[model samples]
Target: MCVQLQAKDLLEQPIWRTAELIKQSKRHVAAPDGYVSSFIDFIELHGGEIVTAASSCRVTSGFTDWRHLGQMGVDFGWGNPVTVLPLSTRRLLGSDEPCFFLPHSSVGEGKGDGGFKVLVLLSEAAMPGFKIEIDKFCSQEFGQL
Candidate 1:
C-alpha cells in the first residue's frame, strides 16, 4: 500500500507522530473493505489526480521493508544467502532513489546478528554527501566508521 504525506503535514507534525499516522493509514488501507474492487475502478477514480501529483513532484523516494520476508534464508541449492541486495532500478515505484531495509544474514535456525541492513540507491552526484553523512552517523553510533 502507498501512503502519501503532504509537505505541510510533515513539517507541522513530529516525526514519531507522522510515522504513527502512516502506520494507521496503512492498516486502514489493508483492511478487507478498504480497497476498490478493480484496477479499472481505481484508475477511473484517481488516475488523473495521481498523474498530476506525480508530475508536480521534483524528487521522489521509495522505501520497502524486507526484514520480515525471510530473504536471507532462501537457499538456491547451495546455502543461505550471505546478503540480499535490491536492484538499482526503481521501476516498481517510479522513485529517483530507493531504500530497502533488509534482514541480517542468518547464522543458523532462528539465529541472526540481531541487526538489519539498509540498501540505498542514489545518484552519483549525491553519493559523496551521502557517504559523508553515513560516516558521521556510524562514527557517532559506534565510535568508528
Candidate 2:
C-alpha cells in the first residue's frame, strides 16, 4: 500500500496521500485537519525549503480518501505518524546523505506539540532499526525529562 511521489525540482510532484480512517477500539473517527496542518507547517517552519507548495490529503482509487491515513497510527499503533513522504528527488543537501522525507510512524498527533519527534528514515536498510527503536521508545518511560 506504499506509494511514491516523484520529486519535481526538490518537491515531490506525484504525491500520494492516504485517507484518515481508523479504529483503535477507542475512537472511530477521521483525523482532524489540525493534525495534518500542524505536521506540514512544522516541516516548513523548520526549513524544509519547500520548493513546491504545501499539500495534504491523498488521492486513491479515483477518490481522495485522506481519512484512511489514520490507520498509520490507530491500527498500526505508530501513533500520529507524520510520515516523511518522499516527494521525488534525493537532493545533495541537508543530511549529506541525500536529504528527503521518508514515511515514518509515531504516537499521538504529530508536530502539533502532542507527539514526540521520533525516527529519521532515509533508506530501506534502516527500517529494522527504526522499528526496534520505536518499540523501545514505546516501552520506555516518558514524562518531563
Candidate 3:
C-alpha cells in the first residue's frame, strides 16, 4: 500500500509505540490514492516523491519500514525460523540521511529485548553527534528507549 513518514524523536520512543505507529500508518497509506480521484493529476501539478520497493530503489531522504513483513514466522521447511535478516542493495539516492527498519533477532543472545534493529545512515559530519545521541538512548535498558 502506501505510508507516510512524519519525523519524530525515534530514539526516545518505546518499541511498542513505534510498532503501533507503523501499524496505524499502514491504514492511511492508500487513502490519498483512493480519496483523491485525480491523484495522478495532483501529483503532476504539485510534484511528489517517488516511492519504490526495488532492490535498487533510491531516495534523496526517506526511510524503509520492513516491519510489516518483518518478524513474520516465515518458513521454507527449514524448521521454525530462528532469525530474520533484512537487507537490500539499494543505496541512498542523493540523501544525506536514510534509515532501515528490521525485525529484532531471536531470544537469548540474539535477542534485541523487545525492540527491533534500525540501520541509520548519516553524513560523516553528523556521525559524531548522532553517535552521542544514540549513546544516550542506549544507556538505558533494552526497551527503555
> Residue-wise lDDT of candidate 3 within 13-87, one digit each (tens)?
677877787777666555665524455676677666653434353334557766668455676787546656535
Clashes of 3: 1
RMSD (Cα, Å) of model 1 = 4.6
lDDT of each: 0.71, 0.37, 0.60
TM-score of each: 0.69, 0.24, 0.48
Q: List the lowest-lDDT window of 10 residues for candidate 3.
A: 51-60
- The lDDT ranking, best first, is 1, 3, 2
Candidate 1, run of 10 with poorest lDDT:
48-57
Model 2 CA lDDT for position 23:
26
Q: Write the per-residue lDDT of candidate 1 for residues 1-145, one digit (tens) a residue.
A: 5556776888898999978887886786677676434445768888764332254567667778889887776889998887777754544455777678888756555467578878788889899999998888887857653
Is candidate 2 or 3 superior in TM-score? 3
Span of ten consecutive residues with least summed lDDT in model 2: 57-66
> What's model 1's lDDT at 99?
77
Clashing pairs in 3: 2-29
Highest lDDT: which candidate? 1
Residue 66, model 3: lDDT of 68
Q: What is the lDDT of residue 29 in candidate 1?
A: 67
TM-score, prediction 1: 0.69
Candidate 2 segments exceeding 4 Å error: 1-89, 92-119, 143-145
